[model samples]
Target: MEDTTQYFDKYEENLQREILKMCSSLGMLDGELLASEDIDFKWKEWAPEYIAVALPEVNNYPDFAIACAGYAGMAAAHWWDEDWGRHHSAEFDSLLGPRGFDDMDEHIVQKILGLTLDSVEAKQIMNILLCCAQKASTFIRHEQIEHQTVKAFHIFARTVKVMFRTGAALELKRLGYKFQKVDLNRQLPS
Candidate 1:
């Protein structure tokens, strides 16, 4: 099997474009308002590639946009390991809805995480998560605030926490790191 780095190299361009498109779709890209420099770069540099990948010709299907967005977020996490990717991952989790939460136990979390960092599973899952994250981040950054922004932000935060926890566990497992299983109620440090 190919290593994570090797796998990512193949999809990095597509991942970047997918992230950009998701961000744009979420309305996060704004030229006028001055926010964090990193955020600006994320929109300008990363988002376009996302757009390219998510374009109808590239993705073909309607749902492909969402899938591309998720993939973008996952790829960003793998590449940057910075705030942009992290936030994008969080957003992706929010979009994924509640379907996967029940299985967020240590074993499942470990398995997913191991799969993610180790490139064990098809990269599609990672791609989905990344795309979701990019969309969420874009929403948070660009959308005008009403009651919905608060709700969305909350969801985004929760999702990010879950993904990070699971992703971290997987990374640890891949590295042959061991840990004790603790209660799920307690929050893991960010």
Candidate 2:
């Protein structure tokens, strides 16, 4: 895996920062999310690779997109643990919707948190996800002529990663968790 962040342009970096801030504003940044810091940007490296692996399981664009969402959900499941690929063929097999993604995120949140996904929060997050998806798709189509490389795919993958993590962060906020910040420049008590 590469430190793919180095490849991100200004707009992509700004978009990434805003989405993450939205997570914090919505109060989705929790221990589970923070725990992933040890990973740094590893998810950025693995998310797009999962896209190629997911080709056989999906039939169209929506399914492919949802599959990436599921990949993000699974990452949230184990604190973005080892990139063991997706559990698409494992226990999460049941969560896949026949024609679309469905409530593909149900199992992980329900099983782990014992809380249901709030419809309102889902709607808000869905809006953000859709926006991110559109940008990614646009990049893929328009980028091939210029970059002529996989940079577009990497950007799209990072979008997928942020979208799902935003969902988890929303859930964490719904569960009453908030992101805490440290004062790096605080003076110690004398």
Model 1 score (lDDT): 0.37
TM-score between candidate 1 and the true structure: 0.27
lDDT of each: 0.37, 0.47
| Residues 23-54, model 1: lDDT tens digits | 33544322111123333333334444444433
Give residue 51's lDDT in candidate 1 (0 to 100).
44
TM-score of each: 0.27, 0.50
| Best-fitting candidate, scored by lDDT | 2
**Candidate 2: clashing residue pairs, number:** 1
Per-residue lDDT of candidate 2, residues 15-97 (tens digit): 55665664555444532344244233444444445455443343356434633563355335444332325532333344343
List candidate 2 segments past 4 Å from native.
Answer: 1-5, 9-12, 21-35, 38-49, 53-71, 74-118, 135-149, 181-190
Model 1 alpha-carbon drift over 4 Å, by segment: 1-40, 82-190
